[model samples]
Target: MTRGGREKDRDDPERKCIATGESQPKAGLIRFCLGPDDQVVPDILGRLPGRGIYVSADRAQIDKAAKKGLFARAARQPVKVPDGLSDLVERLVTQRVIDLISMARKAGDAVMGYEKVKDWLTKGSAATLIQASDGSERGKTKLHPPEGNGGFIGVLTAGELGLAFGRERAIHAALAAGGLRTRVVEEAAKLAGLRGHLPTRAGGHDGGVTAMKDT
Candidate 1:
């Protein structure tokens, strides 16, 4: 499994992380490229032109790469790493995930609100259950995710989820199976790894990951 708890896809292109030296799917890693000024630039969309440098999605790993000069070593030249590189990656990745979720909502492949999500879950139309990480544990426990990999996502906060749904706040949402659903899961796994929302083997409403309780 990747550090994001995602099963490795044999068909997906693989890259070796500079920090851990582990080869994994590119989707589970953050891509970087050298800017015109020889500065290391994050390629969140992975469309940047240049030789790509990869690191696992984990924040600690990114930090290690930045502080330990691993990026320069990988580039085979001195490169300027931005301060707070890991935080920048986290913010960009968070927005990427939010954007994907918004697209899914616009495509009518997603639904929000407790009742709607519950209905989808009951009908077996929901491929993934999304709950705010900071939502009330008791309230979140009222629903359960569908069975399968990528069936639950709890790394996003209520306000962040609200942004995706064009609301002020949201605690529950469901996604139907589709291309967008797969992308959401993949990007969300990256965000999860960055935010330290590691998946546990068991327990909690968010599939196998532990949910954060808001008091």
Candidate 2:
């Protein structure tokens, strides 16, 4: 186990990003499949049938791949890339993260609202702190993230977070250990990298830019 009692995968599979030519964990890369029409499709779940093309989850890396014909090269054949593929991938990954968080909430391992989030932070129950990308900075700065890397996610909007927590809107939220917290963290990290900004608090502040989202 790593910090926070999180299990560390000893043999996590790695793939090389076509854009960066760097090998990293499969969880930190986005998978793509060549559709029947020779169109490149984002396989967010990595279940699509085709020769898989891997790319770093960051927007820059995806853009580079499209601009430089990396996908066709990787597929070893000409493939048509859909316009706005990056945005599509971002949306899909965001929805996946939301769904995971919603499941966590249903399992009673997640909570929303400023008071509840604050309580979790005080009790050290929060393994990750989530804030909205469009939230206000002053409001977000009031609460500190857990002391560790990968403990913060700030990419979803307040309304998006609200959906996960079953509320009209949520500016702050916390994820406790267990449930889907590990998946949430992994996916959120990718989303954060792709968006080129961390999720913001209610007062609006870029948490920090990082690497891409996962499947």
Candidate 3:
């Protein structure tokens, strides 16, 4: 399966990574644009207007691109690379996820709390399940992610998920299908890649009482 969930679509827009020289879907790559001062800037939202350079989302690849002067080479001119480009990308992606989830909640397309999430799943209203990575595995296992690809996200910690839900903390959440879910999945894919994980379903049996893990 593609790390973003589901098989690769041939029609998807593709870009080549300057570091790896391999072309991949934009979903798996980060775009860089040259600033007015000719500094290489990581454009997490990919909306910058200029010639765009691409790099795979992996930290090592991004670091290699920066350390080996790949961006300067790609730009074909002197360009300053910001220190800790990969770390900045990671932070941006995480914030993008949080913003997306918050929007979804405001749109009435998402739900949190164990019982509410389980109810949505039982009623077949939730298209994706999100759980905190640092949450208790025992409690997490009590709720199964929706079946099939892109059904689960385990990349965020409890505090991070809490931020999205506007709560002190959250361990379980569910998203209904819509435009927002698509954006969430895409941003989550980038976050997952930077964090070196491809989200997989949480493994556990139903009917077991479990407690949420402390963050």
TM-score of each: 0.91, 0.85, 0.91
lDDT of 3: 0.83
Please give the CA lDDT of all the candidate structures: 0.85, 0.79, 0.83
Predicted candidate 3 versus true structure: per-residue lDDT over 128-151, tens digit per residue: 999987677868888888876678
Residue pairs clashing in model 3 are: 136-213
- 1-215, model 2: which lDDT tens digit per residue? 22112344758777788999988778888999988899999998889997788998889989999989999999888989889889999999989899999999999998887788999999999988987766656567788988765578877877778889777667788999767988888788778777776443332444543211110
Which wins on lDDT, candidate 2 or candidate 3?
3
* Cα RMSD, model 2: 5.9
Better of 1 and 3 by lDDT: 1
Give the range of the ten consecutive residues with the poorest summed lDDT in model 2: 206-215
| 1 versus 2: better lDDT goes to | 1
Candidate 3: regions farther than 4 A off: 203-215
**What number of clashing residue pairs does each candidate have, in the order they appear?**
0, 18, 1
Instruction: At residue 38, give the lDDT of candidate 2.
Output: 93
